[model samples]
Target chain A: MDKKKNISMAVIKRLPKYQRYLREMLNNDIDRISSKELSEKIGFTASQIRQDLNCFGDFGQQGYGYNVADLYKEICNILGLTKQYKTIIIGAGNIGQAIANYTNFQKMNFDLVGIFDTNPKLCGLKINDIEIRDIDLLGEFLKENNVDIAIICVPSRSAQGICDMVVKGGIKGIWNFAPIDLSIPKEVIVENVHLSESLLTLSCLMNGAI
Target chain B: MDKKKNISMAVIKRLPKYQRYLREMLNNDIDRISSKELSEKIGFTASQIRQDLNCFGDFGQQGYGYNVADLYKEICNILGLTKQYKTIIIGAGNIGQAIANYTNFQKMNFDLVGIFDTNPKLCGLKINDIEIRDIDLLGEFLKENNVDIAIICVPSRSAQGICDMVVKGGIKGIWNFAPIDLSIPKEVIVENVHLSESLLTLSCLMNGAI
Candidate 1:
């Protein structure tokens, strides 16, 4: 396998799709898949899939395609899913609660270590057996725990402050569901999940605007 | 203004980012912004921003910056957010309940008209004054209501079946939160909100793999 160096954002975006389809194929008992067949299934061109996968290494041949199990495992390794990642969610609101209840993460070894909220009423509440702690102790919590990712589910008004706290608290990666755009250092990566964007995309599709 | 024929998916994906940054600029009393300024704020190249925005129309010029409020409203119109869209939520679990409680949608004119669940225990349960309805009656409910978008918050196992029901029930645009990708007709747009993908992206970033 080749080491990935400065991969394009476009290629990075396709990794999860590859992972998802490969897992589906594995579940269906399909052991091998061709670039042509993958293109048909995913609607991407055969060459596009080949180019995206080639960034990691030359695993699949010209005609033989790729072995399902091997490709899935490789993609898992590339995605850092091969190891358990300890995760925490800040702001246990609806979005936070939904994310906290997402068992897929736990199933994939992305453990939910802590859940915190600024709402005083929710400080002592519990979800999925993980008690909601006070946001004030987040820095202390991060100082003590080995949290790999911080999930921000706060509102637009408080998201930036909470994000600053998160960065100051030593979390390097942020999965932000806040409506605002967060500025961070180049070393830290912020993945923004804009719910409105999806809705608007659907709206644009429905209206034949795009 | 261009009619936007065959606008690339790359450009479509950036529309929300443009909309978002413009909204933030408006909030901060920054009324005008050039492509270069937008690029500095969003981390996208100036030419890329110019190209993305030009796909919609000649909003920005060589020397003059675009007006924030006007640009935002124009993008909103382009995104089909100017009109109110009635929406429905299937599978009133944590995800569905959370979406129903998201007032941000209401702020954007995407109104929540119905929330449904297969679980009888949750039928009469209320969130934000809207009671959950029976999933069996979704077809009838859709037939009577003007639901423009159907939000699928079901699990992976039942997501496809609910997707089929939603499509058959008459809603065209679907915002799916299910872990699985649903197969639908070509005309019907199904946007899958894969929370795991985001987490995995962070995982990859955290691992220094991507």
Candidate 2:
């Protein structure tokens, strides 16, 4: 049985939060936790945590709740984060560099393998010791290096062109920071992170509405 | 009588995409459109469009489609985009500067009124002519500038402190780029943009199993 069928994307996204709280509990030697206690720690309702966890096989007893270490391993297995993922950033600009320098990526499963930028002047520049290569050599680099994922941080105008190159280079998934909407083939999965959209959502919330 | 009563956060997040497609159609002089047409353009199902729009009201006829302009106005009203939001950013780092340089924020109904950073060297620096102010002046700046929304692009270690300051300064909403889990008082609302989480999800998809 494949691991993907047991959980949805929404559930997968929440696993990290669950893991964090569980890890803290484990470190503190809190072996057992009720759904209510887990809920309070992770900010989800007790019922929601149970339902989300119930999607997988039964892990918790009726009255005693879940064991911290056991629950952590279950969630980690579901999220596929037990193993590390080799990742490469495509653009070494402000956004790209910030992503490269971010410590969370390292703490998470991602291992930064390489960074690429279009500008010749930026070639050989190191962000946290990861050297930048010219974008022109992307195909050869992908072949030589086992880069399975690409983070697209290029400008909107150049996003599609770079996406095309990345797709051809056989990268399967992309985290797109470009503002424009991209259409990739069905085989390639693209997630658009429009920072402006997120900011606007916060603005709407401030206005006391949705 | 309020827009908040009918829409969920998930539905609200999709409004920008709908508005983008509606604007494109309006520019092309597309006067009338069905939920099906809108769905096809935005890659959502027609039933979802109808269901999401139905929450606001029946804007379309039973058989015929919807008037593009009318639907646009309805979505904008529901999203509270008809009113402008006075926004500010904290931390003038790479992420902060990139966000300030982004032109799309101005295109939306939100305006970047000010920026605050603790770095003495960055206090006088400007991006898009918005000067970075000393973080010590945050409380006064929020009050005097009528700033309602804040973007926190500071380091993870400093995120909680800045969030506390923003809340105390009377800012109602926060868009947090830092990966730390925050605990805010009941009145303050926060949206965490976990960048590495996005990267990890992309990695899972690339591996063909999560």
Candidate 3:
């Protein structure tokens, strides 16, 4: 656990993919897998997997591979999935509503505690049993709820402002779906789901421009 | 244009961001910007910006800086935005419906032509005026239409099958929302929006595990 703080961003990014594959393996009753086999399945090099896993602690034995269930649990712990996260969506727009309707995040322990939108028509509606409140009440709601993450699905122009509010309300993480980048304090972690950028990347690749 | 074919993936990823910032500048009535000024706005080093732009062609003057509109147009061309793409969603689930409702993609010229779902209840329902079609009819519909992109929003178990069908139907690009890595032919381009992995990334960062 002490070694986790120094783990590289590349390894950090790969952890979720590892977690995913491991979870699937667990579901399929795959009890153990050698590094090479796991690598073949994940498309990562065996040495790379060993090195990444080593950053945290020893897992796999020399001849005996890793135990799938054990690795999945450890990866989940590393991903902070051992504890439930209380989250709120700051926009009740298309993306926000969809996220609110998504049961997968809830299954992964991300609880949607509230939803907020500036539009009056959207304010009173409920999605996944969570009501969409007026944006004006967002600050107060944040103060009342122990929200660990804020899902910003609002328009780009309003994203930064919403981000500021969430940060002020003590949000530690932000899942931003907006196009614009939000400037926040050093402690706040941001994960962007930039749809337009992703689409452009596909188009650029399809165009054979890279 | 030939140089674009050899551009690195790192630079290709950065092009969308440059396009976005330039478009914002254009919206603000900013006609031109020096690399230094752009670097300050975009958070990239001026030298990096100059180098990335130099991949396609010479656009910025030695002293006068880059013309915003012209640079935006060039970047769009490089991103294949000069031509419109017909897109279809292969699942009418939460994410699929949200993408269909998103008008921004249409503004960017990714026209959502059809939506498909295995669920009988979802079929024939309309989203953004495009009626959702039965999955059974997807193959025939693809043959009849010129679809440039297939947005896969199905569950992991069904993703690969849907991918195979779309590839057979001649899709050049895939925007996958499922949490599975798709196997595709070399000519096909795939861009994934793995929300679960992204959320885990945020949690890991917030957990200080990396």
Number of the top candidate by DockQ?
Answer: 3
Please write out the lDDT profile of model 2 over residues B1-210, one tens digit for every residue: 565476788887887778778878999999999888888788889999988887777788877898889998887775568887778889888788877877667778678989889999999988888888999988888677767778899988799998888888888788898877888998887877887566656655555544
Q: Rank the candidates by TM-score, best first.
A: 3, 1, 2
* Segments in model 3 whose C-alpha atoms lie over 4 Å from true places: A1-3, B1-3
Ranking of predictions according to lDDT = 3, 1, 2
Tens digit of per-residue lDDT, candidate 3, span B1-210: 567677888888899999999999999999999999999999999999999999888998999999999999989988999889999999998899999999989999999999999999988889989999999999999999999999999999999999999999999999999999999998899999999999999998888655
Per-residue lDDT of candidate 2, residues A51-118 (tens digit): 88877668779999997888888766655677776778888877898778876677877788989998
TM-score winner: 3
CAPRI band for model 3: medium
State the lDDT of candidate 1 residue by residue for B1-210, as single tens digits: 246877886677678778888888888999888888888998899888887887877788667888788889888887887788888899888789889999988998988888889999999888788889888888899888877888999888998888888788777799999877789998888877888887777788777775
Assign candidate 2 its CAPRI class.
acceptable
lDDT scores in order: 0.85, 0.80, 0.92
> For residues A1-210, could you state the per-residue lDDT of candidate 1 as single tens digits?
235776887677778888999999999999999999999998789999888888887778867889989999999998988888778999898999988887777998989999999899999988899999998899999999978788999888888998888788788789999887887878888888989887877787777776
Q: Give all TM-scores, in the order shown.
A: 0.94, 0.89, 0.96
